[model samples]
Target: MLKVPDHQVAGHQAGHGHPGPLIDDSGRFYKPLQDDDRGAIEAAFYTSFSSNTRVPDHIRRFFPVFYGTKLLASDGSGQWPHLVLEDVVSGLSHPSVMDVKIGSRTWYPEASEDYIQRCFMKDRKTSSLDLGFRISGLQLYESEESGLWKPDRKLVQHLSADEVRVVLKKFVSSNSPIDPNLNPDCSFASSVYGGSSGILAQLLELKSWFEDQTIYHLNSCSVLMVYDKKKELKGESSDAKVKLIDFAHVTEGNGIIDHNFVGGTLLFDKVHLRYSYQS
Candidate 1:
């Protein structure tokens, strides 16, 4: 929530302003949060995991762990906007990141109905993709030596080599039939989450067929780049590791598209350009 002057917003929209918690000179991010529904939600989640819908389980795996919520008092706005959350990446060793806007963008000052429809669609898709971060950061690999479209050499990923290999081995060794329609591994790899944008025409199509979900956050700037080798020093658990940071504009919806009209999907290539992937 850094003070955004009247004009410095993206596409001239105040809502599009820095969508995450504000970071001051010291790298501290102030996030506003709330959780009165936790008990009810947790009770419902226990049953949801066993359901065929599979949304709860998917959320548990890929969504950032709720380290609990905090209540805050308002100082300036005159109204008590008690919604404050601790920025997920506030204390990571080296935090750098990017986000993928799932649907279309209408960055103009006043968004049109079509743009609003697409933006809502993006929110739904994002909530589903919250599970993407859970698949394992090991599936993603970025080198420290800077290059085009490269995530920061020291950027943190959801999976590590050790973590992903275990999952990969299980999948490869499994005798069970892997459903081609629901192959999240391949689909996520081709997603903005996995960071590849080479052949999007097909990938976007694949996204529609499989790996459709939501993560809540809406802005493309919600992604974080956090890399800390010695992050867990004192009995710290992996669950607290900050994956994505912002959750300002969250929504849920199910929309279908005949073609891949995703305008501002943040592919890794768009973030960093490597020699091999560069055109």
Candidate 2:
């Protein structure tokens, strides 16, 4: 049976008579196709990406495993097409997830003037213009008893650089929630974001690929980070995962370097550096 995903930590929600993401019992994620060209564009990108042999296997691992599309019964009588993807957080007891939208500029050169203007305004209003990324949404699991700590999406999107740092620290910390006074020790930083097999390393691998490949320019895409908070609390080894998602705005590179995507990856490197220094 398809149902609302309880493990969803971010993105458009299913409510108020609107259809959103759904998941099946087989650990497959179902993202409802948008009503605009974005749906077709995203479907094309994934279809092409999956078949492209030029993309290295290691880098391809960073993207959600696509299983094509399916027409599923909607909330109403109509059937909707949903992109079937692997549920990145499947099997986690308590997942802590964050969706960080990368890029200083989200709109592509081919976008309409009005669309560009809207994206420009949004980028300036958020930290994306200055910081090269913005936290679209996040949810940290406190415990089985306390449940998840999810802040308002609007507030998270508008956070300053300093505030972002605090939130990043809090995500790795097993202490009290987002309180600065009761600062956490960030015990999971080394395991989750550092080390040879950590998120930083994975992102660096992606950056290396983006530094060369010119096949696609991913605009307004987010890097989804996930980890099992319950395992961290139990002193188990970190199992952090990172995946690139949301390809509605992807465009062909036409042999030109994707400076915007590269810049976003570099910004993530900067974030890791600062986080390391502070921790």
Each candidate's lDDT (Cα)?
0.29, 0.85
The TM-score obtained by model 1 is: 0.34
lDDT of 2 by residue, 127-220 (tens): 8888788888889888677888888889999998777777777778888675558976787888888778778888999999999999999999
Off by over 4 Å in 2: 15-17
Against the true structure, what is each candidate's TM-score?
Answer: 0.34, 0.95
Tens-place lDDT digits, model 1, residues 1-279: 453221111111113221322333343333332223422333233233324254444234333434333333334432222222234444543322233223333122234577667655544433223322222112122223321122222222233424322333222111211333432232112222233322233233333333454422133323332222222222233122213333333322234321121232323123221211221
Tell me how candidate 1 scores on lDDT: 0.29
Cα deviation of 99 in candidate 2 (Å)? 0.3
Which one wins on TM-score? 2
